[model samples]
Target: MKTILITGASSGLGKAIGEYLFHKGYNVFGTSRHPEKVLNSPFPLLALDLNQPETIGRCVGKVIEIAGRIDVLVNNAGVGIMGPLEEIPGDEIRKHFETNLFGPVEVMKAVIPHMRRQGAGHIVNITSIAGYTGLPFRAAYSASKGALELLSEAIRMEVRPFGIKVCNLAPGEFATDIASRRYYTELSPASAYAEVYGRTLELINQQVSGGDDPVMVAYEIEKIINTPDPKIHYKVGPFLSKFSIVLKRILPDKTYEKMLMKHYRL
Candidate 1:
């Protein structure tokens, strides 16, 4: 059986992926900052906090000790932040990147060496469709996921000769508890962005709540793992959400920007 490790498996998309793969009979180990708190998990949860670098190595080590060799590493743990770029605190931005970007990078570092020794492995980084464009209120999220996409491209090539594969799975909005965890800058009446930003925020939350089921993502991940030669990027979501990436590519720069502005009624 192929051993798989997924970060941030406590809830949301990560939990869904872990559950799907576990039932599919893969030897899956998931990471949560507090494993004991995640009760009734089908597979065991390892303690790993993305914000704590020390926990990363230990978590990977525990997986290796238990499973002997990890066939796949899924970097699915991340956080969300939203607000007018100017108003979002610098510290919060840094903290966001720490979880969404640097955390995954470090996890990759921890797992790669063992995969190299085994002479085979795959790493799937869960990115976002928002990464493809600069969304008005999700500037930091866009940058972080975009950076991970590019980083995956670079690492995929670097690890190819070692028999390890790297790819990005960018999902659009899904019905998850992400909105509850997202950090939102205060919407004060005196603030210039209060009216439009508040409206956009509500729309964003609604979109997430009404979005496609995350099981689709779990199925997609399973497909990627089973394919002999997986592509560098895989996008899963609603038709319009997936098509938005294409629209950005073909449409004029300002035209796309205008469309987005109109979508948010900004």
Candidate 2:
């Protein structure tokens, strides 16, 4: 059985993916900040805090110690930050990048050498459709994912020679715990964006509540693992969300911006 290591597996997409793969007979090692909080998980859970980069090496070491080899590494841990770029504090922005981008990069660095030694492995980075096009009020989150998307592309080429495959899995809004987990900037009455920010936040919550089931993403991940050669970029979600990536490629910049503005009522 192929051994799989997944980060942020306490809940949401990460949890779903881990469970799916576990039932499929893969040796799955999952990570959460407090693994004990997860009730009755079939697989072993390790403690991992993406914000604390120093803990990443230890977390990866634990997985290797238990699994012997990691055939797949899923960089699925991430946090969401929502706010106007201008008003979002520097600390908040740094925190957002620390969890979403730097954390995954650190995990990648820790796992690559082992995969290289094994002669083959797959690394899946969970990004977002927002990475392809910026989202209003989610500037930091969008930017972080976008950075990961590009980084995955570059690393894909660099690691292919080592029999290591890197894929950027970009999903649109999904029915996950993201709504509750996301951090929002304080909106004061004097703030210019207060009214619109409120409306946008509500809209975002509604969309996420009604979005695709995260199990769909897990299914895609399963397929990617089974395929002999997987695409570097896999956009998973509903039709419009997946199409948005294609639309961005074909539409002029101004047109795309107008469409987004209208959709968000910004």
Candidate 3:
């Protein structure tokens, strides 16, 4: 059986992915910041707080100890932030990059040597559609994801000779605790962009309420993990978000901004 490690597996899509893969007979090593919750996992679990660089290596250690191999590493642990760019402080912006971008890169640093020795492995960085198309009030989140997508793209080439595949899983809106965790408490009590904040929050809430099922995302992830040679980028989930991304891609800058302003009712 292949061994796979997934971060942020305590709940949401990560939890669903862990459960799905374990049910499929893969030796799933799941990680969360809370070690106690590891007991709740059906598969083997380890404590891992991405903010702490050391925990990543230790988590990797756990997987290597039991399974003796890690065929896949899914960087699914991330946080979100909302509010206008000017209103959101530098510290908050850095926090998003630390958790969503650098954290995964650190894990990759720890795991790549093992993968190199094994001669083959898959690394899936779970980014977001926000990474590709900047959404209102989520500048920091989108920036972090943009950095992630770019980093993964570069790493994909660097690791090709090593027979390692680095892929991006950009999911559209999905049902998860991501909203609660991603919400920027530090940037809250919005005064500078009060109008924008309230309006964007309402739009976000509606989307979250009707988002796609977590299991659907889990299934897509499982497919990515199983494929012999998956594409460098995988886009999945809600159609509206996907359509929006395409519109942003094809339309002129002013036109796209107008559409956004109209849709956001800004």
How well does candidate 3 score on lDDT at residue 135? 77
If the candidates were sorted by their TM-score against the true structure, best first, what order would they fall in?
Answer: 1, 2, 3
- Candidate that scores best on lDDT: 1
Displacement of residue 81 (Cα, Å) in model 2 is 0.8
lDDT of each: 0.95, 0.91, 0.86
The parts of candidate 2 lying over 4 Å away from their true place are none
lDDT digits (tens) for residues 129-174 of candidate 3: 8899677888788889989999999999999889898999998888
Off by over 4 Å in 3: 185-192
- lDDT tens per residue, model 1, 1-266: 78999999989999999999999999999999999887889999999999999999999999988889999999999999999999999999999999999999999999999999999999999999999999999999999999999999999999999999999999998999999988888867999999999899989999999999999999999999988899999999999999999999999999999999999999
Angstrom error of the Cα, residue 256, model 1: value is 0.6
Candidate 3: give its CA RMSD in angstroms.
Answer: 1.7
Q: Which 10 residues in a row give candidate 3 its minimum summed lDDT?
A: 183-192
Deviation (Å) of 123 in candidate 1: 0.3
Estimate the TM-score of every prediction: 0.99, 0.98, 0.95
How displaced is residue 128 in candidate 1, in Å? 0.3
User: Comparing candidate 2 with candidate 3, which one achieves the higher lDDT?
Assistant: 2
Clashes of 2: 0
